[model samples]
Target: MKIHIIGGGNLGSAIAVGLAKNAKGNNITVTRRNIGFIQHLTEYGIVVSQSNTEGISEADLIILAVKPHQVDAVMAEILPHITNKIIASVLSGITLEYLNKKVDGTNTVLRLMPNIAAQFGASATCISARTADLPKANVVTELFNKIGTAVIIDEKLMDAGTVLGACGTAFALRYIRASMQAGIEIGFDAKTALAIAAQTALGATEMLLNQQVHPEQLIDKVTTPQGCTIAGLNEMEHQGFSSSLIKGIKVSLQNIKSE
Candidate 1:
């Protein structure tokens, strides 16, 4: 696949690196206003372009990784060159209807929500597109799956998925940071604390994935009657840990909706 990612910002660069690492005979091009910032990507045999039109002209898939506010200008720049190529956007809050309208319905559009973890090939990406574009959408799903898990969902749920899967990455990291802080308070070195916290989180996630069990089921197994785990869990609840996370997610969704 010849993939052109417009906007070599954090997300765009991460996706480029991830795809390059996978090396599936894909020719990847990434663009940025300041090309110097992403020039290193060329070391991985990824092309770096400063021209959106030039990049889009030679690609089979055009990924819009630009900011939501930049979409209009970007679409204008590439609209004349766009053909039947698959257009997948990683821009949050940009609806399919908006994209279609901007391009004058010249392309098949798919909205993707993937986090920073894609750089490490562990992103949980969500995808959505019009029903008529399912075949192209599946191609995108497969492309993202190379970096991590990708699920097709209803377009209406894309914003919710962005909060839970995209912003959720930061939420998970914050919890890991908290665990490390607690470890430090209890006498572990910073490095050891970080490793323990990260590995424990990874193990918990793997268990859920492998067992296909509910999180509460695993919580039950860890929380013995009158145990320290139960005590800590209860304390976290008392401190509104879960409530804070839920509220945070809701706020993120509202922000997207308002945008």
Candidate 2:
């Protein structure tokens, strides 16, 4: 695959680096006006450029990772070269309908939400395309799977997926930070506390993924009648831990929809 990624911002650069690590033998180019920020991508044999049209002309897949407001200008510059290419957008709230209308419905358009974890080959990318475009979308799904897991979803649920899959990374990190703080208070130094908290969270996630069990089932395994685990869990519940996280997710979705 000849992939051209525009914008070269955090998300774009992450995707480029991730693909470079996992999708060997595929030519990838990432463009940013200020090329210094992404110059390091060359270390992985990725061609870094400051020209969108140059990249788009040579790519089989063109990923638009620019800010939502920049789409019009970008389309004006590269639309002519994009015919029949797979056009994937990582811009939040930019729907396939908008993209289709922009490209005059000639290209295979896909909307994808992938977080920064893509740089580490662990992002959970959610993709959506029109029913007729599913076959092409699957090609994109397979491409992204090289960096992380990718799932096809209904366009209507894209906002919800953004909240849960993209913003959710921060929410999970916040939980880890809080856990680390608590660990510190319980006597471990800051560095040791963070390592333990982060590893514990990773282990718990691995268990859920590996066992394919409900989270409550694992909770049951950890909590005895009056164990410290249960005591802490109950205290957190009493203080609205789960409810707050749910509310935060809901608010994030609401914000995305409002935009």
Every candidate's CA RMSD: 1.5, 1.1
* Candidate closest to the true structure, highest lDDT: 2
lDDT of 1 by residue, 57-114 (tens): 6689998999889998988888899788888999988999998887776778889999
Residue-level lDDT tens digits of model 2 in 1-259: 9999999999999999999998788999999899988889999999999989986766899999999999999988998876889889999988888988998867788999999999988899999999999999999999889888899999999999999999999999999999999999999999999999999999999999899999999999999998999999999999999999999999998898888
Q: Could you tell me the lDDT of residue 190 within candidate 1? A: 99
Deviation of model 1 at 250, angstroms: 1.6
Pairing residues by index, what is the TM-score of model 2? Answer: 0.97
The global C-alpha lDDT for each of the candidates, from Candidate 1 onward, is 0.91, 0.92
lDDT of 2: 0.92
Query: Which segments of model 1 are wrong by more than 4 Å?
Result: none
